[model samples]
Target chain A: MAHSGINLIFEGQNLPRLLGGLWITIRVALIAIIAGGVLGIFLGVLRTFKNRFLRFILRLYLEFFRIVPTVVLLFLFYYILPKSMNLNLPAAEVATLVFTLWMAAEASDIVRGALISVPQHQVDSGLAIGLNRSQLYYYVLIPQSLKLMLPAMMNLISRIIKTTSLLLLISVLDVINVGQQIIEANQKQYPQGAFWVYGVIFVLYFLICYPFSLLAKKLQKD
Target chain B: MSWQIIQQSLPMFQKGFILTLQMSALGILGAIILGLMCSLCQYFKIPVLKQIVGAYIELSRNTPLLIQLFFIYYGLPGIGLKLSAYTCGIIGLIFLGGSYMAEGFSGGFDGIPNSQIESGKAIGLSQGQLTRYVVFPQGFALSIPALAANIIFLIKETSIFTVIAIPELTNTALDLIGLYYHTNEYLLVLVVGYAIILIPLSIILTWLERRIRYGTFGD
Candidate 1:
């Protein structure tokens, strides 16, 4: 057929635009991962400390994130926060903030679990060797916990990437959003464009996430 | 911010809340059935089917429900599969949740010891009888925690149903906000509605898990 649907995806600059949209998704996920990773590791270490009140508050923070859906959080930030706080921010920024907060909450728990899973006797030995608390953690606990947490962290990265699809809801111009735009623009000419467009979006997401998941599985087995 | 606006919107929110619950209940049921089928395929080592299940799990696990919904709601119509938004929402949930539940159930299936199977065989129980009595119970009990988590997760995921124009809680709130610009009030009620449903469900699930664990494994 002269006006076949799949051709619309490659018609002129559509594919490049979609790739650009994918870049936006990747950029947001990367910022969140780096910032959230550092913050989460700190919070996780603090979680294992013997401070009862701090641990209680951290528990509440984690619970809040867990109980609330990410889409709700995204809406809260993207819609309500700007008006309530009377501060203008970009949708992409709001997305980054929400995902970073969500990532921090999840990553902290993973970190806490990894940290605590390390044998207590090792900690005791580190302390028994005239090592300061910071030294003990830096030299002994952090290294051990890193190995335990990496796979979970990789899984979390994929999750953050997948959940970035929700960015389309907040008008973040992600790949899904771009695909919609393409479908709408070509709707008159190519009635069946949506299937190929969304199908491509699906494959794009699968490509990005599959490797992280596979890596997680491999590391988990190790 | 206005109490009157919030009060007026309560009915809309309530209707949406009920829809959310209804959709999630159906989705969860379908997911359990589908997940059980997948787990059974793996448990029995059904040649080609096992490999297909493995691939399906990986594919579904890696993609977000939002894309899957768009593909079905907007895309499938292209290939002559025009389902309603409601049907598509439930289908998407089942497709996504089924994989997760399958993983959870497979974990349970794997946890069932070979010794138990051997013991069942020693008593001359057929494979079907052993699966019904020895395996299903223990595996299901072991899977309670995971299954509960998946249920809660599926419910939370229902929020994205708004994207396809389903009048769920989030959709209702956004609609009210678009109309009245009462973002503050609607958002508050939306959060409260979800908290009311999810928090109690989580607590009750935790309690149920404890009860089941005690009944099955018995400390």
Candidate 2:
């Protein structure tokens, strides 16, 4: 009846439990991407403002967050911020916030790349047709760049899902954390459950991400 | 933020900085060799090996470096294969960085037109000579910017080693908080520490990108 005696995943209900953990991972990753995408679009558009001071301010903001390590950012939000402000925030909130900040920086890069790449000749042609700045961007520029932007964002979707694995570090009960807990609980019976558990975790993640990665490649070719 | 705080921790910061440098240097060295081998495997249509290399690239590229780190650092030990935390961290980073580098080389290979390869063959060069004289030089030029960018990313990634408590820059900052009891100050110091190292490298990357774009390194 057994598939194999050395089957890596647990024999019974643990497979279902592990799937539940993966579901949490998928949920958190989706929320972070959506939130980050929205914020990133705004920041990206804001970065295009003509005023030097505003651009300087945004550049500093985006650059600072971009350079800082994500784990350090995680600690700042999950540990130090709560302790410093004496206001308790849940680990999920911290993970989401850190990821959102990270995604915003990345997304803004995508947006800026898209916007900048709209050829000046195209803009000049739009101007010749009496289109205003908004119309020029709305009708012509964004459409051209949107093709480029979408594929990059698709790449980020997988990136977001992969990154959610880091939630384990902050003690958020994501798939990796759940897998770790399962291993810890059953260490006596299966000391090497880690090999199996983490292997399965890798497969779960690979299944989710590889498709998006392939799609991004396909879109880039298009 | 404090001068005294910064002054007293300079030595400790240097040690951490050196470790970060060592890690990146080793990682880039390993990645170059691994990336070249993988790219050559792809270029030559090495059958099953090519498929394996492609899968490795996808798996390494798509997964989070931290998850890969956990697998190498923790999961391997469970199977009776153990590496020190530093070694595990570096190996994980090399795989991640190498895959990106390999992909870049593949893209670079794509850029070298089929006509060029045909021309090489038309010249009656041997297969080894064709690959040596034809593929690698142009691909290397095309891949330099990507290599530089991958190196920068790998440098930033060394920060992840902090989670495994390897005393890299970010970890050193964490350790500094223990000594100074000034969390925000060390955070600021860590930013400065990283900036001092990364900003120059990025400038070089930009310059290399321009060089490649402007045909300085071209056929």
Candidate 3:
């Protein structure tokens, strides 16, 4: 029996459920970007600190997060940490925590790269103007670096939105998980719902990512 | 910090590590071949083939690997074409990695100045001979850094296989964590497992990049 019924897949109540899931997806991504951005910038600066020990520690932090897959990190946070620490939290919270850690590490690298790309002469000239170290960084370094970093940061945000799909595996009802639910519920009548469901997911993700890619291109042009 | 758990988990983790390595090896090979073919298509200006390759690159690059994996694993089965999770994962990796690698290879192609190609032709070299003797070697050399980075990316991306129940490193770590419930130790194990594999990989890549830049084999 070919279950090519679109009505069965897009049943009465599933639309709302999917919309809810989409909302959660956006919420998680936004929160992660903000929290991760602040922490990433801080760590990025810490990475360039003159103190060798601090830089070493920051490097270790960066390497650990960069190498480990986010799924493993999510598993660690959601399953392992609770047992080890004897603390229980909601799945959404765990997803947020884990993704924040992941994003912070990624964003920190972007920030570091952006900061380093600024011309050294600009910093030197700021210093020559009797600007203190803090003043030079805040007044000169940051302004120029932000322009370079914005596009990269936008790219990172798009990445985060797409990666939020992984949160589905951890029991967070994101859009992909919602699609899974619709597929399961209507499997008999809409056996081919997996195609439509995943196709919709691809469209949703493209919608989220394509704009940022365009923005990155525009920023590069400017 | 506990040796007891490490001892218990060693066999499983080791097995998973080997599986991860194999998957990445296959994925990297598939990606290199596909990427090279696609790059060549664009370079040679094959009209329709180039446009199709460009479309494939954009579609693959712009989407998440997890969705692509699910599409292959779950969606294909719906159409009565079932593949094992490992196969699906490998296909997904190839599709994703190929696009990124094409970008890198194209970058390599663009880096060669027009004069180089023209000069080779002026020397009475046939196109094939010129590409083989001149363009190919230099383009490959210039692309070493990008190729190395893509290799690392492919390694990390293999983690997505866990969702489809592939017995790779992350899946093994999850299984171990589920078995022991010793969160800290298991998390530590997970961290160590990835670090041991990736750190050396990163070092080797960095060294390869440096070697390519300086045209010497010293670290």
Per-residue lDDT tens digits for candidate 1, residues B104-151, read: 999888887788889999999998999899998889988989999999
- State which candidate, 2 or 3, has the greater TM-score: 3
Give the native contact fraction of candidate 3.
0.68
Candidate 3 global CA lDDT score: 0.84
- Candidate 1's TM-score reads 0.96
- Ten-residue region with minimum lDDT total, candidate 2 chain B: B210-219
Best by DockQ: 1
Tens-digit lDDT track of model 3 for A1-222: 544645554679877887788889888888988999999988887776689998888887887777877777787778765676877988988888887888898888988898888998998899888999788878987788999899878878877887888888788888889889899988777788887788778877887788887797699669
Q: Rank the candidates by TM-score, best first.
A: 1, 3, 2
Q: Ten residues in a row with the worst lDDT in model 3 chain A?
A: A1-10
Question: Any runs in candidate 3 off by more than 4 Å, and if so which?
Answer: A1-3, B118-126, B214-219
lDDT for each candidate structure: 0.92, 0.82, 0.84
Best by TM-score: 1
- Candidate DockQ scores, in order: 0.84, 0.59, 0.64
- lDDT comparing candidate 1 with the true structure: 0.92
**Per-residue C-alpha lDDT of model 2 across residues B1-219, encoded as one tens digit per residue:** 478877878898899999999998999889878998898899889999999999899889888887788788878887689999989988988888889889877778778778778989999988899779987777787777778877887888888887677988888988878776877777777878888888888898889787775253253
Q: Rank the candidates by lDDT, best first.
A: 1, 3, 2
What would the DockQ be for model 2? 0.59
